[model samples]
Target: MKREMIEDALIQPTILLVEPDDKVRPSLMDNLHSWGYTLIVALSETDAMQRVQGKGEPFDLLLMNQVGHSVAELVAIGRDICQHAGLPPSIPVVVMAECYGDDLEGQDVQMGDYEYVAYLEDGQQLKELLYLLCPVP
Candidate 1:
């Protein structure tokens, strides 16, 4: 009998996107899917928590909307997911908002004290930030 080697599985980076806007979700879903990312969508914080703490495969990153929760609150949720869901502590968490006064195109505004938590104001910025966070090998 001959033994065959099993090749290492290729794991595409998975993202949990918590956006409630009906219009925005489809566009983001299309974009991220085209970019080779595995995306999971949740419309509310409750849904996000369920998915995060669920027993399924871990998400590589979290992208949330600030419509329902503040940046601090989202960060806390990410911490909780790490604590309760066995996700890595270093998993990137980014928050998206429709617009901001100082938001420039293709740039993520850094929230103070939680610089790793990006504040994205537009689709371009979100795209740039996502690619930066999970660069393709």
Candidate 2:
């Protein structure tokens, strides 16, 4: 019998983690790996975009920490990258921040939006969010 090829995405979910905080990056990296995700880490948004623009493995989800850019900006960047990569423009984006500005306070999630900001308190919180977004096959 002939065997069909399997895509990496079908085997394992790939996550593109864009976190600029030196202190926070390590833990996120560890947790993603422990969760059995194929991760590509970028310390900055530009770097993250560059990786997406290249011929590297396509990312399943974008777990980004709002550094210098706003949450909406990052989502747009993800979409733009997806367009360039010839993929569907429906990338799921999770924005992690210790806290949002006054305007965004008390809002944990934006219902029906493709991208939402969440408080990154601990790995457990992240894991729960990941479960909803990325399901390993």
Model 1 sits at a Cα RMSD from the real structure of 3.8
- Tens digits of per-residue lDDT, candidate 1, 25-58, equal 8988998888878888888767777776666557
Specify the highest-lDDT model's number: 2
Measured by C-alpha RMSD in angstroms, how accurate is candidate 2?
Answer: 3.4
The residue pairs found clashing in candidate 1 are none
Candidate 2 — worst ten consecutive residues by lDDT sum? 1-10
Give candidate 2 regions above 4 Å deviation: 1-10, 101-108
Which residue ranges in model 1 land beyond 4 Å of their true spot? 1-9, 103-106, 111-122
TM-score of predicted model 1?
Answer: 0.76
Candidate topping TM-score: 2
